[model samples]
Target: MSGMSSTQPWDVQRLPRADDKVFLITGGNAGIGYFVAEQLSGTGATVVLGSRNPAKAEVAMAAIRSRVSSARVRAVRLDLADLSSLRTAVESMEVDRLDAVVHNAGVALDAPPRRETGDGHELMFGTNHLGHFALTQWLMPLLSTAPAARIVTTGSFAAKSERLDLDDLHSRQGYRPKRAYGRSKLAQMYFGLELDRRLRAVDSTVASVVVHPGGALDSLTPSRPPVHARTTGAWLRMAPAALLVHGKHAGAWPAVRAVLDPSVRGGQLWGPRIFGLRGKPCREPVWSQLTDTSVAARLWDASCDLTGVDLGTIPG
Candidate 1:
């Protein structure tokens, strides 16, 4: 419920025109992130994708151009695991203002012998949480320059059930892949909320919003050739999953709405409206776990200490 006086509901196909605005999406080369970038480019905005691989980024950009005529799209080299490269990644954008940034890139390890990032931090936690934490610091100057810049963090439903064990942040003990991944995403969700609180306290023009792509499966996703293609058998095999989940294309809606929806406010959580699993995007209540100010604050401090980048100093 956006509480807007619209005869029709929000249409994923028809987004509000964001011409002249510059939007950035990390991991916009594949999966749900690709769809998010594709849909956003339709609004006539210059979409910059943050990808570690230039070749893959070019392929995704080519696919977008073929689908959407007059699409303005490009990519920058971004490797979230390496902290030292983040400043250069932000610098490569070369834009005076950033209208919005979707922190959609993440590293999810399903099974692992507990790997670590280049910085010796847990891979999932470092890339998904700390990488984004540091990236936001570098992007702050450009974000603050926009009239109403937005920081949209793409969280996960897995984050709902996890709690951070600050003592063993690197998972030196009792390391499970799923648990570690969930905690990493949980930290990201916490950061988004904490950042929103801080931004609100300062009355800054920048807004930090959080969103989750409930259950996006490739079986239900539409194809963008060369970038991705679903086989008929795979679609049939996973068709039943659609009853409870939707395609990755649909999953991009929540994050897309968070970025472009004017009615959305800072600190709000958007997700699938039906059972918080599958449906169109809607303003969902903050999960009780996510609303904990204490955890959010603690995580914020730890993130700052680890990243050596403070979000506390956003230019006025």
Candidate 2:
């Protein structure tokens, strides 16, 4: 249990080569996603941003370009809230194969009440978990082209609030905004870990890893609050430190490390080395002994059924 601080062991600057490599980052326009893209693209990787709003995507691309004069970056439309959007974006992208798919996009619905996506699934469940679930499955084949493809999905410290709520995953029974958000994040971790298990079973080149930002950075102060009040407050306390102590690169380090670090262990969690909720990058444990393996198995089947994506060819 490391605590948040200025000192940490691993840093992404040590990475050797990223030139010519291709990467796709969901929600790459802002927050840790933006930093992840910046770090990778600065190193010469061709980073494609997946954003819900095409216009915002362009703006994000421009911002990154301004920072990294020679950064290779592009933006494409990707709406996790709509299954159709995810399909359209993936089909339209021109990359033959991706070196990594950073599954970082997620949503939070606070206080007002439970909401539903265009596909009628619980907003949090659909956007945060199912949306990325489908995207990763669809792009799984393209990832195999790389020597060691990685899938870095974002989770949250809030996941500790509860286990998988299989009976009412959509929060239909008792819709609590915070609870729904937590459930979605928990699902992400379970799926990420399970995907790793599947990859090992099939000996696939792709590896699934999960990371959490611990908290938001102060730079995001103006933009971060509206995402979700409860979530914002839960993470805001760490923002000052996240910004002052870690900055953009530090905020994005968990996912960046999870994606590019060869030493990253499949199914292992990474986050701020200090309090884990906030600090620099390092390996951290998240799952409990009672995490419900059966739920993981069932959720995999349910995701395939929900997304109409075939997992038969992929590992278990």
Candidate 3:
């Protein structure tokens, strides 16, 4: 697989059977997350769609059931912006083992003005990085119980242009919306890569992989009942559907591949083949900054400090 070119074919059709596996996807109620859930559930995995909104989660579950009658799926409420909510959500999970956890939920392009989460951290950074950091650490035990688990963190093309300001992780200084979003994504990638290194050092079976969904647009995503509403506006709304290169389902391919592809390895990054805007999933090169161990280690320590959670060493 390593010798294959970037355009090598990979899609939902190639996903392995997951009948005995159990997986959780944060923000699985809509967009790329929703499609990831649908595809995985269709393959017989017991999928937990973690969302902040119960109604939206139920709608996503229904959509999956409607599409795949045999889908084994459920919904759980999870608000990445709230640490209390993250804890409650983890406690409520009944599964004894988690085969994989896909960190797919996050704030997108039009993030609101710089603000703080309930924990007093910047909203974008808190929700996108700190929340997942805490959640993944808290769930480490369950993940270790599985024979071979995976932690899939969703990254973005924006990370290529952003640099992490370690001193100002909260964006206390000048905070542009796009730059903030990029910084959060870069943090996420760093966490995933750092996690893989730590897990390997401890001889753990869990793999940590980062993936980018390219440029998935809600305008191109069909809405499900009871929650999501379809794109309803003038040509401006439909313009994204027509202009964006790929659909939401296609955007999910990279994360899906990260989760299930046997050839994928720990610390690897995946994204679209065509400049990360659109195209099939492929193993993409990591940004030079993300590959720096010193930076990753610093980010890991900072995340533990900010979130007040730690995975310790891998379970024996």
Residue-pair clashes per prediction, in order, are: 0, 6, 0
Residue by residue across 130-240, what tens digits does model 2's lDDT show?
999888867876888777888898888788667776778788887789988988988888889888888899888788888887765544433322221234674567655
Model 1 quality (TM-score): 0.97
> lDDT (0-100) at residue 129 of candidate 3?
93
Ordered by lDDT, highest first, the candidates read 1, 3, 2
RMSD of 1: 2.0
Candidate 2 is scored at a TM of: 0.87
Residues 1-316, model 1: lDDT tens digits: 2233344578887788888999999999998899999999998899999998899999999999999998999999999999999999999899999999999999889996999998989999999999999999999999999999899999999889888897887777989999999999889999999999999888899999999999888889988899989999999999998899999999999999988888888999999988888999998999899888998988888898888888778665
Which 10-residue span in candidate 2 carries the lowest summed lDDT? 221-230
For candidate 3, write residues 63-173 as lDDT tens digits: 889989999999888999998777779889888999999998998547656778889989889999999999987788899999889999998888888889999999888
Model 1 spans > 4 angstroms off: 1-8
Native-referenced Cα lDDT, model 2: 0.78
For each candidate, give its TM-score against the true structure: 0.97, 0.87, 0.90
Give per-residue lDDT, candidate 1, residue 278: 92
